[model samples]
Target: MDAYRGFVMLLMAAELLQFHRLHEAFPSSVLWGLLAYHQSHVEWAGCSLHDLIQPSFSFLVGVALPYSLASRLGRGQSLQTQFSHALRRSLILILLGIFLRSTHREQTYFTFEDTLTQIGLGYPFLFLLGTTRPRTQWIALAGILVGYWLLFVLYPAPGPNFAYEAVGVPPDWPEHYTGLAAHFNKNSNAAWAFDRWFLNLFPREKSFLFNGGGYATLSFIPTLGTMLLGLLAGQWLRAGLPARALLRRFLIAGAVGLALGLLLDVTGLCPIVKRIWTPAWVLFSGGWCCWLMALFYGLIDVAGKRRWAFFLTVIGMNSIAIYCLVHLIDQFIINSFHIHLGHGPFQVLGPAYEPLLTGAATLGVFYLILLWMYRRRLFIRI
Candidate 1:
């Protein structure tokens, strides 16, 4: 688990490297281009390494739940006490997401689509589902995914009079779909409409318009579906199947998920959009997540290959701290490096690599901080 998580968090922390700077400096360079592509989002539909970060984090949450619940029960905590702890953690995650988004802003952002906030919104329900039988959990996953898909498909797509510019999506945006698929258009779907009403209930610098990135608060519903996938995976892990059997299960599940997701996208029944967390996306990304779990589990745990995963396990064990550190301290760390080293070392590789150099140093500091916490056994949880 720590190895898988470390891989995800390391990917997140790598955002500091600013590979796009090099890409911009040499747009035709395939190496920089591939790095930049994976580092950034894919505009709307399809997935990127960066896109998987959130779903993986959320999936791990579900994966950890069985172990967590068993541990708590072993300690004699009652259901009520467990629930109270879950509630407390939910609130903290939601507020923390808002607080992070509101940094340098005029007031609280009140956005619920952040990775932390999205997980927080769905977590309690996931906990409830956690206690149910596998059959019940599967049914719940189907209901959530199908119900969310129906809601968007049935919601009327924006008409001609709607102001596209106000929503940060140009009417002529190449990504826009025509026909029934238009129901999933950027900032024009049911989730966006719901946000128009829901976000306004809170204080804001300006009335809640559309998210510039086309993200919506209601994405938590399908995000829960992703977590459910993880939840099921968790149950399988705890069943104590042999390594070969477990490996086969994960691989088959991943293959099925990928096939189903692709079918949905190709038939135009639903689009594979990560920004909106569409049902198709849940299947597609969940497939990838499953394959990843298989890889880490097989290589690190099953094969007893512990030595190489040490780097990732360190960051993974302290996932929450690294999440916050990446957001809250990037600028501080970069500034400190400049103040002490005077940019001399960073500039040695030429001007385009300055951001890369500074970012690598900042990432190093982040690792050191995580290492310190790991050595002290101080993992920051809920």
Candidate 2:
């Protein structure tokens, strides 16, 4: 867990750097690859390492849920109490998501399309659906996936029987189907007209072709399946299975998931577009998520050697807080200041280096704040 956390934190640091254009200055091949691996969000039609990040986070949420809920249940909490607590937590996540979305200067109002909001909206419902019999949960997951597929495939968006070309855009250019949904719904703010238009016209028919519907409602289906997979693993771990047995399970499941995802991709049932959250993408990503959790569980919970994993663990412990802080620091604080490195003693550096210096400075500031919060034991829990 600690190592995983540290890995994610370092990845986050790299992401921050890339986001701020620091990546171009101190361009190490290894760092570039790592950044590329983590930062290259899948273009509409294909999957990439970056696409896995969000789903992985969601998968972790599911992975933790059973353990946390079971811990509460073990303490003799009633089912009603547990359900209510879950709902409250879900609500908090949803509100926090809205808060994040609203923080965007371009957005005029809260929308359910935001990542955190989607998690907030989807997760509790996932949990509720999951708690039922395994068969029922499986059925529900299938129902959603197929239902969503049919909704876009047959009914089409904007209106029933909408023509595909009318909604289509150039293949290589980045597109936003959700933005289109937002536009059609008039949910997007008017400040960003180009973004709004692109988002709204995102194709409905060939979403599986690219980054189509990954963020759309259809994604919840396979995502729920991923959660169920996590639940099964959690149950296995809870059953007092031997460490080797758990490791074997992780390897086997990961292999199966990868294989299945690849098969789906090849067969064209659902091309592996992470943005659209196709079943293939879900299976592949979820498979990786399972293996990662298993690895963390083995090392942290079983092996009991965790000194190096502290950094990421800290970030993970305060994932939401860190996410919000990262955003706030970037959007409002640093950008607003417009502090230049070339002004004084820092004038030794040229214009090209300014971005790097500024990025490092911002990251350093955020890290210090995180360090202080960690020291004060002031962990934010939503």
Candidate 3:
């Protein structure tokens, strides 16, 4: 779990790499183009490596819940105490996410769609569910996905004459779905309408408009579904199935999830939109998360390959600290490098490689901090 988590955080920290900078430098290079694409988000109704980051992080939260509950109970913690902690943690995560979002703004951003906030919003419910049986967890997951889907389907779709530009969608946006799927189109769904009203309740530079990226606070609902999937997987891990059985379970679950999500997308019952955390996306992204867990578990635990994962374990153990470090001070570190060492060092290989090199140095700085914490056995838990 630590290795897989470290891998996820590494991907997040690597955003400093800004592979997109290579677009102009290697316009025709397929590998670079793929790298650039994976490093960024698709406009809508599709997936990318960047897209998996949030789900993977959210999924891990659920994956850890079984263990979290067990550890607390083992230490004689009461259910009331656990509930209080979960509640407190939820508030902190939501506020922290808002704090992070507001760093560049004049006031608190007041958004709940951030990865941490999304997890925070649903964390308590997840904790409550943690006390239930595995059958109940499965039911909760189904209810969330189906209920969210129905809510979107029941909401009125945009009229033919509706203005797309009014909601920040481009005039020529080519990803718009037609027919039933139109209900899930960007900035025009039930979630968007809810945000238009919900977000305006908070102070802002201007009236709450559609999110430029079409993200909505209500995404936390399906995000909960994603987490529930992880919760189930974590329970499976705790069940102590033999190595081969666990691998088979995860592979089958992953394949089923992928197939079902794609079926929903192709049949137009729902579109897989990560921005809104659609039901299809819950399945699709969850599938990938499970497969990742299986791979990390099989290789690290089953194959006895522990040394290779030490680097990731360091990062994974300090995930929260690094998240804050990267968000709060990554630019400072980047600037320090350019100021003290000068751009010449990063540009040694030519302008095309400068972004990658500078980013690598910044990432190295992050890793060193994490390594220091790891060596000292320092871990920041919620």
Candidate 4:
């Protein structure tokens, strides 16, 4: 399920990027719709389909936790051994995330701010917390969210005064909070220097001590909540409930999550903002994750529809490979081939065709490579 979703997301991203590149070649609405779907990340505030992507990834981590742990336990692994394994896995993921973040033309060392790193850093804490009784996990999850809210809300710097009063503040106030956090953490990329200078009140030198408010920190709390929910779902799924019962539970949970999120947003206690990973953001994004899981569970596990599942399963099975491949392809292969469609034998095609045709061809080539690997049973795991 995880690999399948990841593959779908990657293809969606590629299709969106392709459509964006061909905006001028297609109808305005079609182009704009694709662009909107691709542009899922919230600009600085509020929720969008784009914002759901990362949360979905985190949610899947949670969903898989129960099954993975049970399998380990079945193998006669002690609790400590299982935990050690989880910790090791988390560390590897974090390192990989750091590798991705620092894989720049100029960088030579790891950085700890990327999504994978955040997940890697966050997951062990979650696993440790989750290993307790379910009720205890729920309490811990709630405690984390409430504690985070209190910490940021009452924190002397970056809240109420600095965040509330900042002029021309980005819609996502959390970005400013991250700036404050980056100041203290001093783990930021220089590429974002201009963004820091203009949006944040304190200069890098002065406010370096106060940099930890944005989505990254909030992620610590709400994401834990997300993982908790996933754990809960995993537990429920593993309890041998009937398919209909599971589906009903998922729908009910999703509805409740969405309702609570909306209510919180309406009350202004927590705005549905992804950049900040606000509490409302948690419920909203989590609702979507639940819905997707329900749908997939029904379609694949319940319905026994395995034909279409293979594609996503392949990508899912070797998701990390696919992610790295996509990135490398975009950075090196596709960019290197500046096909001049209007020259020589390709003279008939215009400049506009270059982006569309080239992008399609490149994507097709990569997809085929993935397909071939899948057929040959060459699943890569890390």
Candidate 5:
């Protein structure tokens, strides 16, 4: 678990590298292109490694829940106490997400599209689900996906004259704008519609419109489903299944989920969109998450190959600290590097390589801090 969480944090921390700049500098270079593509979010349909960060983080939360509840119970904690802790944690996550979003704004931002906010919104329900039996958990998962899909399908798709241009979708956009697929189109789905009304309820300087990135607050619903997938995996891990059996389960999940997601996308029953957390996407990303859990579990837990993963475990132990640090001080660290290291320190590598050099230096600072925290056992938990 530490290794997996650390791996995800490593991905987040690496964002300081500004791989996109590298891509722009070397559009023809396959290495940069691949790195840039994986590091960035996909526009509408499809997925990317960057996109997996949220799901993996959320999934890890679910993966940890069974153990969390168990630890509390083992300590003879009351149900009420556990419930209160969960509630407190949920509120912190939501407020922290808003606070982070409001970094440069004059007032608090109530956005729910961020990973923390989405997890916060769905966490209480997830806790309730955690108390249920495995069969009940599966039933809840199915209901969320099916119910969310039904809501989108029942809502009428935008008509031909629906003015896709108004929402930044070009009239000739390649994604489908008809049938079931249309129900999940960018900035026109049921989730998007809900945000239009919901976000307006909050005080804002300007009227809320479409999210420029096409994200919706209601994605948390399907995001819950993604966590449920992790909950099942967690339950399995706790079940004391044979190692081979656990591995088999992980592989099967990946195969089934990837296959089903592709099937839905191909058949146009629903599109695989990460922005809105379409049901297909829940299954799609959930599959990859499962495989990742298996791989990391095998290497770190099963095989006992612990030395190489030391750094990842360090970052993972202080995941929240690293997350907040990266968002809060990225620029400060980069500027500090420029100020002390000299502005033209990286010019020898060429003009386009400056960002890469500075980004690498920023990442070095981040890791050193994390290492210091790890040494002192100063993990900052919610």
Candidate 6:
């Protein structure tokens, strides 16, 4: 679990690399093109390596929850106390996400589209599902996806006059999408509509229009399904199944999810979009997450090859702290390196390499902090 979570955090923290800069610096470089594509979020209705970060994080939260609950119970805590802790954790996650988003704003952002906030909103329900039997949990997952799909399909599609530009969607965008699929078009879906009114309920510097990226606060609904999938995986892990059996199950589940998600997308039943956390996306990304868990579990826990994962486990151990630190103090760390190490060191390779150099320094600083915390057995969890 730590290794998997750490891998996700490492991916998140790697955003400091500014892949676009590299791409711009070497537009014709095949390596940069590939890196840029994987690091950046897809504009709409598709997935990328970067897109998996949030799902992985949310999925891991589910993976960790059963273990967390068992630990609490083992400590003699009552159910009420566990509920209180879950509630408190949920509140903290939401507030932390908001606070992070509002860092430079004059007022609260009132947006819940971030992975943290989405997880926060959905966590209580995930906790409830966590306590249910696997069959019950599967039912809940299906219900949530079907209910959300119905909400989109049943809701009236935006009329022809809908202002796609206002939401940063080009008029001719997504050339292949039409008909029912168009209902879930960027910034025109039911979730986007909900945010139009929902975000406005809070005080805002401007009237809430549409999210430029087509993200919606209600994505937490399906995000819970992603987490529920993780919870099921966690439960399987705890069942003491044979290692090969466990790995096979994860691989088979991943294949099923991937195939099912593609079927939905190809059939136009649902588009596999990560931006909206579409039901198809839940399964698609959940499949990848399952495979990742299998790989990590097999290599580290099952095969007993633990040393290579040490670096990732360090960051994973203090994942929350690194999450906050990267967002909050990234610039400070980068600037500090410039002031202390001097520009000569970073500029040695040439000015084109500056972003990469500085990014490396900042990432190093972040990892060192995590390493220190790990060595001292200090993990900050919400």
Q: Using lDDT as the measure, which candidate wins?
A: 1
Count the clashes in each prediction: 0, 14, 0, 14, 0, 0
Name the better of 3 and 4 by lDDT: 3
**Per-residue lDDT tens digits of candidate 2, residues 1-382?**
4356445545555565553243455466566555655576755555565666677666666667777777887899987887788788878876877666556454433344455665676777766764677677667756765554444334323333333343343323344333223221111112122333444453332222222232443344456665666666666666788888888888888888888878866665555656446566767877787788777877777788677567667666667677778756574545644654333432247765555556666767776777788888888875
Per-residue lDDT, model 1, residue 187, is 93
TM-score of each predicted structure versus truth: 0.98, 0.76, 0.99, 0.79, 0.98, 0.98
Give the deviation of candidate 2 from the true structure as CA RMSD.
7.0
Question: Weakest 10 consecutive residues, lDDT, candidate 2?
Answer: 183-192
Model 6 lDDT tens row, 1-382: 9999999998998988887788898899999889889888988878899999999999999999899989998999987888888899999999999999999899888899998999999998998888889999999999999998998988777778877788877877853367788778878888988988999999999999888778899999999999999999999989999999999999999999999999999999999999888889999999999999989999997899999999999999898999999989999888888888888898888887888888988999899998888888888988
Candidate 4 C-alpha error for residue 333, in Å: 2.0
Q: Which runs of model 1 end up more than 4 angstroms from their true locations?
A: none
Best of the two (3, 5) by TM-score: 3
Ten consecutive residues with minimal summed lDDT in candidate 3?
169-178
Q: 1-382, model 5: which lDDT tens digit per residue?
A: 8889999998988877788998988889999999999998998899999989999999999999999999999999998898888899999999999888989887777788998999999999898899999899999999998999999999888887888888878888886557668888888888889999999899887878889889999989999999999888999999999888898899899889989988988899988889889999999999999999989988877798999999889889899998999889999988787788786987779989888888888888888999998898898998
Q: How accurate is candidate 6 locally (lDDT)?
A: 0.90
lDDT of 3 by residue, 110-195 (tens): 89998999999999999999899988989999999999999999999988888999999876789988899999999999999999
Measured with C-alpha atoms, the lDDT of residue 63 in candidate 4 is 76
Q: For candidate 4, write residues 110-202 as lDDT tens digits.
A: 344455666777788878866778889878867866765555444333333343323334434444424323221111222123234432452
Question: Would you list the rank order by TM-score, best first?
Answer: 3, 1, 6, 5, 4, 2
- What residue runs in model 2 are displaced by over 4 Å at the alpha carbon? 2-6, 9-13, 19-34, 104-107, 133-168, 171-214, 332-353
- Pairs of residues clashing in candidate 5: none
Model 6 lDDT-worst window of ten: 174-183
